[model samples]
Target: MSAHSPLPSHELAIRVRALQVGFGTRLVLNNLELDVRRGEVLGFVGGSGTGKSVLARTILGLVQKRAGRVEVFGEDLDQLSKEGHRAMERRWGVLFQHGALFSGLTVLQNVQVPMREYLSLSPILMDELARLKIALVGLKPEAADKYPSELSGGMIKRAALARALALDPELVFLDEPTSGLDPISAAEFDELIKTLQQTLGLTVFMVTHDLDSLYSVCDRVAALADGKVIATGTIEQMLAAEHPWLRTYFHGTRASRLTLARAQSTGA
Candidate 1:
């Protein structure tokens, strides 16, 4: 963040270089490079099995990379000490697909998971903070005591988002956040994400196949194909691209539906 820090002064939240990952005889990501700047939403897209999630997990250290350098917040992940790594991990949040909330834990308890693991706050203070996060994500105060099973799908996503935000992370990674929701619910969630990103000055690295999300929220799009990012740019740039996959994706049937919806919303 500092002018003299090893990281670029312009604020690069995440940097990946020549990243390679393989499973048995197959390589999912090979010689891949990416950069996520601060205070922007980057929608990462790829065909099924093209490794969008794999790329995200590799950057988060959940998946091992066969090769490459991953720098986060001006520090190389592979070069950090154990304590340093722990500290760095605390600076980011993740909302996996399907919400990934703990079924047995109440909403408040779920939100407190990261705080409890990293900080030593008293019960009352932690409870207050957890509730604050819950409300911050647009959940009602009463929802805090409910279990994941009791919440609707949309509420579950909001709860998980609250938990992801509990630690006040500078960056967040969201994978397929709109996957199971109805179109209306998904649109609401997209608006919520956009609001949160602007209000919090948070950088977002999202892996999603949702055309509406990409069109409505993302500042940039990164298209992964054949083991690397083939194109990265705005929606118009993506539409203009000639990459086979990019063309098919941005001009496909699903994208047309979103276009129609946008036109209808604007009364065009």
Candidate 2:
């Protein structure tokens, strides 16, 4: 096997090696290594300030890496020139933590921004594409004209998701997709993600703290600690882990409470 070979049978959508990021002298990500396979939902779970978002931004080329290689879809991010980067960026989409919608733009215009910038389709075509994406995320036709302020939190998230899907990207990055929503809404959003992943055959790299979302939507979970991926595996494997942090993270107080409640209800 070559030095680069790890899980060679799987098609790697994102690969990082010895990834280091720093804001001056303080290192954020320290010699991290990770791989995300094609058409899989890999959930990144870690405590705050563990570099989850930093890792995401580094992959997106929004932040400069101090050292190491980040390859997305087999293209080295560090080597891409400005034009090359933009060209490659068209292949992916990002749904940010707070939806990150332009407060000034209406929902339709927000979804059309990327299509206008990256695609040369005609005006009618762009409108049609925007509307199609909007509808796909379960938004009503009438919602398109409304501003971000007019929509509920769930609607805003769905609108942002619609915009993220506007380009039909093969790889999607979702940062805290279900954050700040009611339980019902969050579950609904998870269902939407699963539906879209199946329907579009997408590869999703999601950073989330929601355990229920992880159990429901993620194929694998990668836990970040000390700027490295400490543990990564299916939910069952993670649950079986004896690592202190892993145990506390997955089967913590809340989880134990839920389990006990279920046991009592079932008399098991």
Candidate 3:
């Protein structure tokens, strides 16, 4: 229930209170409460099937909540009209776990999808803006013409990220952005995320299991267990937690090696 010292409501980008979600008889999230502050990367982690993605989806209004309040940019989601909800959606972007680019569309077309839906710009303008987003994400101009089938895994992630940024959103939700890449590629992607988040002044809510990404990019981390956030703090605080799961997850053999490597790298 405790988290990093909270920001005032005006400084929060997304807030969830007293959330409860269930499927049939099984409750996935029970009385979950979370806050995402503006202009920071908040990493959300949990064991597999622990409703991490569900929380993100519920906030985005993709899944129905049994009971709760979700507020984005200070407006309660339940209070918005259909038109108002659509407007609220324009303020955020999402990069799903897998690059959800359309198989039939080129990268440029895929990036233009949001623009086409949310804007009334001419085709030429849309094309130009889409190219700019592609370039912004570190993809080559030539990659704009390629289909998702033509990209490397890393390239696909970038292309998906470009599409996510198509609307120039203020808040972004990233689901396992580095999941499929090799170590080198994952590190590079993490750097790109950190850079873009800073440059764009974005509030990011990221659902991920990658320890390296947590260390390299996140400003704060929240861990979920038993259908609620069990702990929230810096990596060092998480490592020092007394909870059994936290003890096991952060001090296990692999994590010990990572900690040792980090200390050695920093000459700590």
The top-ranked prediction according to lDDT is: 3
Give all TM-scores, in the order shown: 0.92, 0.91, 0.95
User: What is the descending lDDT order?
Assistant: 3, 1, 2
Model 3 agreement with the true structure over 57-138: per-residue lDDT tens digits: 9999989999989999999999999999999889999999888899899999999998999999999999999999999888
lDDT by candidate, in order shown: 0.89, 0.88, 0.91
lDDT of 1 by residue, 1-268 (tens): 1111244635899888889999999999999988888899999999998999999899999999999999898799999999999999899999988889999999999999999999999999999999999988778999999999999988898899999898999999999888888998899889988999999999999999999899999998888999988888888888888888888898788787777787898996
* Candidate 1 Cα misplacement greater than 4 A, ranges: 1-10, 260-267
Superposed Cα deviation of residue 139, candidate 3 (Å): 2.1
Backbone clashes in model 3, listed as residue pairs = none
Candidate 2 per-residue C-alpha lDDT over 1-268 given as tens digits, one digit per residue, 9 for 90 to 100 = 1113366534888988999998888888999888888898999999888889999999998898989999888888878899988887888999988898899999999999999998899999899989999998889999999999999988999999999998999999999999898898898888989998898899999999988788889998888888888878887778887778889988898866755675697795
TM-score of 1: 0.92
TM-score between model 2 and native: 0.91
Off by over 4 Å in 2: 1-5, 257-268
lDDT for model 3 comes to: 0.91
